[model samples]
Target: MREVPIRENSIRLGQLLKLADVVQNGSDVKELLASGEVLVNSEVELRRGRQLVRGDRVRVGVEELLVS
Candidate 1:
């Protein structure tokens, strides 16, 4: 469990991944999301730009990233 601080609750999900070091680049995050490898709040997330808030829990494969 880790925290990714944000000034606003309108941050994009893909950008959050970068902050959490889940993926190296935008393309990598995009690919992971597109391939149905990213889950948000328990369901698969295909939208890379999905809005994420501080309480949202995002999971990429075996890695779990929490928004803070």
Candidate 2:
């Protein structure tokens, strides 16, 4: 697990994916989400616009990213 710092109260799922380097670009985010490979707080999440706040957990593949 790793901490991903955020400057705002919340961030969009797609943006967070890119910000955390989970994906290379917006297109990658779309594809990854469509494949149901993204998880939020241990549940599958497919919405690119889902709002994420501090302490939220995002898992992609073997990596776990915690918002902070």
Candidate 3:
């Protein structure tokens, strides 16, 4: 797992994906989410607008990211 720092109290899942370099752009988020390849805290998450805070774990494929 790798730590991904955010400048705010919360960040949307879509933005986090891009910030973490999981997706190339915002448009790709929808397709990725629909494919059921994204997970939040080990549960499948399909909402691109889902809010995430510090310590939240997001997994995309084999990459796991920890929000900080």
Candidate 4:
């Protein structure tokens, strides 16, 4: 289990991508997100602008990221 802290309760989808190391650049977040490779709470997430809050778990490949 890995944890990433959001400076504010409101974090953008692109920000979460970089924090999760799914993409090296924030600019590529949208592409990665559109690939339907990102999962939130075990469900496929396709929205790059999706809002995330605490207790949301994002999973990519074998990585499980916990937000709090």
Candidate 5:
């Protein structure tokens, strides 16, 4: 598990993916997200625009990232 700091109130899921270095770009995120490989707080999340705030947990493959 790793902590990814957010400097604002919240960030969109796709943006977070990029910020966290989970994906290379928006297109990568879209394809990855569409493949149902992303999880938010342990649940599958398919929306790129999903709002994520501090304390939220995101999992991509074996990587677990916590919003801080």
Candidate 6:
């Protein structure tokens, strides 16, 4: 997994996805979520507004990102 740093204590899942370069845009994130390809920790996450704090893990396809 790769680390993606955030200035704030928490970040929205959609914003994190973009920051990590996991998706191209908000639309892409929506589609990806609908497809059930986005995971928080180990379970599927469909909420774009899901709050993520330090040490949270996000996985999409073959890419895994760690919030730091």
TM-score of each: 0.89, 0.96, 0.97, 0.83, 0.96, 0.96
Instruction: List, residue by residue over 1-68, the lDDT tens digit for candidate 5.
Output: 99999999999999999998988899999899999889999999999999999999999999999999
Rank by lDDT (best first)? 3, 6, 5, 2, 1, 4
Off by over 4 Å in 6: none
Question: Which residue window of length 10 is worst by lDDT in model 2?
Answer: 19-28
Tens digits of per-residue lDDT for model 6, 1-68: 99999999999999999998888999998999999998999999999999999999999989999999
Worst 10 residues of 6 by lDDT: 15-24
The lDDT values for all models are 0.86, 0.94, 0.97, 0.82, 0.94, 0.95
Give all candidate RMSDs, comma-separated.
1.1, 0.6, 0.5, 1.4, 0.6, 0.6
Error of 5 at 40 (Å): 0.2
Cα miss at 24, model 6 (Å)?
Answer: 1.5
The list of candidate 3 runs beyond 4 A from truth reads none
Q: List candidate 5 segments past 4 Å from native.
A: none
> Candidate 2 lDDT, tens digit per residue, 1-68?
99999999999999999998888999989999999889999999999999999999999999999999
Worst 10 residues of 3 by lDDT: 18-27
Regions of candidate 4 where Cα sits further than 4 Å from its true position:
none
Q: Write candidate 3's Cα lDDT for 1-68 as tens digits.
A: 99999999999999999998888998999999999999999999999999999999999999999999
**Clash-forming residue pairs, model 1:** none
Candidate 4, residue 14: how far the Cα is off, in Å: 1.2
Q: 18-46 in candidate 1: lDDT tens per residue?
A: 88888899899878888998899999999
Q: Poorest 10 consecutive residues of model 5 by lDDT?
A: 15-24
lDDT of 2 at 7: 97
